[model samples]
Target: MSDTSKPWNSPMPEPQFDLMRRILSAPSPVGLEGAMTYGVLKPHFESFAPAEWKLQQFMGHAGVVLDTHPGRDDLFKVMIIGHADKIRMQVRSIGDDGKIWINTDAFLPNVLIGHEVTLFSEDPGAQGSYRRIDGGTVEALGAIHFSDPAQRSGEKGIKKEQIYLDLQIHGENKKQQVENLGVRPGDSIIFNRPIRHGFSPDTFYGAYLDNGLGCFVTAEVARLIAEAGGTEQVRVLFTIASYEEIGRFGSRVMAGEMRPDAIIAVDVNHDYVAAPGIGDRRMQPLEMGKGFTMSVGAIASEQLNRIIETTARVQDIPMQRDIVGPDTGTDGMAGVLAAVDCVATSIGFPIRNMHTISETGYTKDVLAAIHAITHTVQALDALPDPHREFRDNHPRLDQAGALEHQGSEKPETADK
Candidate 1:
């Protein structure tokens, strides 16, 4: 397209890399999300939310849902899916010498031996409940520097069991000091890597891009939709599904809660991460700067994919199609099983080094994804009978001839 044409199509504000960085820096490690991350992310959700949009937190789960579905007889529901959690370790025990023994649900790379980290604990500061308290620099045993350097063995292949943290205060009365301050087992520990400026200004290097970027993008989609006074035809819902890393807890908890017409999900994928099999941008299936990865799976709605593909072209956003999964290793599958027979599909964002402190994402591609989702949401309003294509091809019954879809039909949208 010519330079003049580009300006006309690009109407949205520059994607907020800052917002993505903010969430990325905050720690929302798996099951510990409510204790560490929910409060951190709540402010952002409140700030960007429009008056018509209703933001609600699910205590049973560790994430938030922003509802924009209108109160009407005929309503189309679209869920923009993303997880709001990351990988981290926990304090299993506090040694008498002021050392903290850690345990993790996820496999953290041994390369973390020499990295700095933050310890999150609870304190009832004036408030009636346990508030977040900084526990200071996490001192790992095998780190680069030790007080007596020559005494070190230059260890290799460190395991989580062998690791320990230095709480600084030690010797007699050590356990008492830590215990009195509410430093107990089960507190979360996360790497101390702040969101840093990447190779270029537009690029970002931070923790939790796997879904921090996903969460940010989901919120951005909601913000864009809400700004336009919500979609006329489809009542759009941008959901930050939590605990996706460890078998999708958020998706399961909230699944079938609302029987939407279709479900759409996105997460930073491994397709474009710096890898050998993926090479040459032109030949790559899904690479950075190539746009979003449109995954085609059995559970994914074919009609939704068609609509996304059409919207991508119209918006001049490049999209790569992947034919892989009976279960796409994403929230889409969980959503599929949960909601009787809602159409399920996903978009994969390109990023490097998932499950690391310094995951990398291209700003241009991230912004492009936001546009693609925004355009698809916009198209839902303009498209007539968007659900027909998927419905016609949808499964009618099982081998035993029982109806595939049997549940509470939509009484009305949330607003009603």
Candidate 2:
């Protein structure tokens, strides 16, 4: 609805989509999510705000805080945080011969079989890159053919434990050879994939599109605000949190460490209007090239929710909502229950086949998401401070100061 006038045959903007590919190309499976946040996203934060940006990481988790306003010092802030972690695996053990064994919470195990993967380094502090150790695959159905169908476990179909990492290196001592290359029993493992275009070519395909676009939009919103000369007026604490795919652990750590006046979480949802077969629209809507969505669920921050809704309407950003849930099942929940009890809300793009390799979405939705987030910050700047009302009434609430924002701070130093 925004601008699909450019025919489907038209090529996407080279520079912008290339950057999205570079971002989605980085591996941040599960526990190593913070690595991608710092190593991949921090550069964009710096490129967008340079002197005003800062970063933080803890136990493989990372946060990129953009200090748009170096002039003012206040706990009154808004954080656009998204979980940067994707469900990935760890090298559990290896077979004496050349076969390998792995363990992980692959949400969709069937989708992983026969796909490529990477064997990353053991150093928890190391950033994940494509060059680490490539050309690994999960065992296939016919390759490891079972005699009987009943032998499979009903609890977790296509058990990842039984699935082996087929490095396919020819030799008697394959384990020893892989180990010599720094692949260890405990090294982090992730799906090794390059970002490719979907069938229409207007949409992008890859793993972690679930929140990859969310992380993209969060930082892009800050960049957009800065571009519109709205940064100083709208100070957002942008964080690329980790472990969000499995749990809200990264954001939990972030909330404990810093306090913001309001939190607007940017994330993704599997709300394609055209699903394979479905009765409920709440599950997903039939949308592809339209704008993004907003949640009208229990956890929405009243002030922030109304502001986003109004902004989308006034700006005429094409979108749909009513994908209601109790707490958004996102880091937005962390913002709702944080120590400061700040106002929290979420706006996200809808993606199809969410956790699988073929996850697809339109750039139009992505740009709309970026616009919505930036507009949220800009709109919040115009409205009353949602957190200020609570502060006036409850002076005894535990107050947290912003970490050393500018420079020369211990943990405040950019972890990149």
Candidate 3:
């Protein structure tokens, strides 16, 4: 619980907050992120980016990268990437009764029912142009009275195929009206919910916080770095990627092209402390207000983690160590996937109810991440030779010291 009586003072400026809202609200379904990346974020990046910084646009996807020192391979290249795309439902088919069937992507069927959504329909008449259809609510069977005994009881679960959207259409020619409006298969559908402040101070909830928050953080960090006169020894690439929800496809392509020396993948993490029934499983205790999360295992680079953590400690920024192993499960794997041989790590704020229409986050944590990453870049720039630092900082087994032990040299035969 957080204090609500105190007057709300935003951690970020009003313009930045407005940008966050616009970026999160923009329709950016997987593989169709041009509305978000190109339309919303690109202009914002151009507004404050220094004159020397170069904006890199991709050919295949709507990914954008802001390079602090373009074509400077001598300096250490650090890419901070956040995907601009979000998971969403796609129109699969239309029923004669005006119901639109959907293939729910990465969403629980129960969380979607009764929630309003906006469908971006591709017009059959005009290819490459889209139209927005609003005021539709996802539904299943309409009423509880129509449900079977299992559905009423806890014994049954809602299936994804059973869900459909209702536009309140009537009359005999229902499907015709829908088709005439250009609502067809493959159109993107997203929650029409907008980002709004939560009951507690410094908290906000909305749809698509999973990676919108990530992109917002990346943009803010870049702005902060630019405001501080930019980095000296490091050529930072502030990158916004696409298709992260489907796979790390877009990031892999970006990494392959840029071939940065290091990458910091910014994304959202689960607030396991606030998650329901999470105590039943072994999970890290993380929450919205606990501050930003930094990865500790897997492909997380020790040198980069050291720089970030040391900066946090010196700057008194609250941070939580997240144990991500085998794979970071974010775009941190993009470097490895692309065979770029770059050191990588992930930074995020713990979010509650991820992949839902009501994903929640704390502003303080977001600001903390911004400050921490900004300072870490500054620290990297201050180093005389960052490439050598990362390459040589790995622990050497030869320098190991033995701990005092009270172990009798094994009577191995007797133990066996």
Worst 10 residues of 2 by lDDT: 1-10
Q: Candidate 2 on 13-54: residue-level lDDT in tens?
A: 778788777777767777666556777788777776756555
Candidate 3: how many backbone clashes? Answer: 0
TM-score of each: 0.80, 0.81, 0.93
For this target, which candidate reaches the highest TM-score against the unseen true structure?
A: 3
What is the per-residue lDDT of model 1 for residues 1-416, given as tens digits with 9 covering 90 to 100? 56344422333234455566677776777766663236655676677776776766777777777778535426777777888777777888978777677775564645455556677676645433444444444445544564244435544545568666665686688878878778678777777776766776556677767777777778778777777777777877667777788787687666667566777778887644466555664444566656678888667777788889998877677677866457777877756567556777878777777766677777767777787888888887787765675667654446445557667776575332
For candidate 1, what is the TM-score? 0.80
On lDDT, the stronger of 2 and 3 is 3
> How much does candidate 3 score in TM-score?
0.93
Ordered by lDDT, highest first, the candidates read 3, 1, 2
What does the lDDT come to for candidate 3? 0.89
Q: What's the lDDT of the predicted structure labeled candidate 2?
A: 0.69
